[model samples]
Target: MDVKEGNELKEFNMLYKEVDELYHRIALEIGLSDSAFFILYSIVEFGDGCLQKDIADHYFISRKTINSSIKNLESNGLIELKKGKRRDMHIYLTQAGQKFVEEKMMPVFELENGVFEEFTGEECRQLIQLTKKYVMLCREKIKETYHLSSEDL
Candidate 1:
């Protein structure tokens, strides 16, 4: 790449790391581990009765990490697991979980919504479009470089 292109790539990577660090900071502020925060966040987003596999797939987190976090949450009585039809477990928030989410998770949602409120609708659309395109291209490049198939992803 030319100098300008290389500089742009560096900037992009820096911005990506900054965004990740911001999430880590938010998790710390909320007194939760990164895995736990993401687990709870996914549950809230996907609604009750979401599956462990769904959370792992949606968030690109490892199944081991997801399983560990689910166990922790279960022990705390913040979530419960029930058997689904096909031997998979469905996760649900307990009464305490509902209150916990209302107290802890709601503020994070409000903060995220507030930030989006500052952006124009067109800007938000562009941001999502560009991000998705970048992710697709990145995945393709990784696959090509490693000779990986879609299933590997």
Candidate 2:
């Protein structure tokens, strides 16, 4: 890449890391670990009885990390797990969990919504489209670099 392209890539990476850091700070401010916050956020996004696997896959987190956060949330009385029809566990928010989400998670959702509200519809669409394209291109490059097949990813 040329110098300008390289600098642009660096700027993009810095912005990405900064966004992640902002979320981590929000998690800390709400008295939760970053993983725990994301776990709860996933539950809120996906609904009460979402599967742990689904959360992990959707968030690109490892199952092990999801499991650890699940244990912590359960211990804190924020969530409960029950066996599904297929014998896999489904997570549910407890009564306290519902209250906790109402207090903590909803504001974050609102904040996110508020940010989007500032963007025009076309801008929002372009942002999402470009981001998805960027991710797809990155994944393709990684697979090519490592000689990986689709199944491996």
Candidate 3:
């Protein structure tokens, strides 16, 4: 890797960390733990039939972490688990959860949406495309190093 490549990686990592920190602060301000907020956001975004394994894969976190988050959200009455068509446990947001998101999360997203104020729609799309590609590349590298199948992680 060249100096430019190293710098780009560093910048991307810094941005990722900054965004995570911002999420933590906003989650706390809205009376939720960071993990609970992320879990609730995923449930709301995915709507019904979202499985625990799906959330774990989506966040690249452990099932244990997701279980903890789900427990917290359920205890708060922000979400519930139901049996899916396949008899799997699925996560769904409750009415109170939807109301809270409307009154709280949407505003937070609206404020954070300013991050792309200087970019055109196409630019934002391109960034997301490139980021997804990078994520796949990283996954491949991990699989190679661990000699594991996609299902293993």
* Models, CA RMSD each: 1.9, 1.7, 3.2
TM-score for predicted model 2 compared with the true structure:
0.95
The global C-alpha lDDT for each of the candidates, from Candidate 1 onward, is: 0.90, 0.93, 0.83
| Top candidate when judged by lDDT against the true structure | 2
Off by over 4 Å in 1: 1-5
Cα error, candidate 2, residue 9 (Å): 0.6
* Residue clash pairs of candidate 2: none
Task: Residues 1-153, candidate 3: write the lDDT tens digits.
Answer: 646645778888899999899888989999988777877777666766588888787877788888898888889888889987775789887889889888988887677588787789999999999999998999899999999999875
What are the per-residue Cα lDDT tens digits for candidate 1 across 1-153? Answer: 646645778988999999889889988887777888888898899999999999999989998999998999899999999999887999999999899888999888999999999999999999999999999998999999999999998
- Candidate 1 or 2, higher lDDT? 2
The C-alpha stretches of model 2 lying farther than 4 A from their native spots are 1-6
Q: Report RMSD for candidate 2.
A: 1.7
Per-model TM-score versus the true fold? 0.92, 0.95, 0.77
Local error of candidate 1 at residue 100 (angstroms): 1.3
Q: Which candidate's TM-score is highest?
A: 2
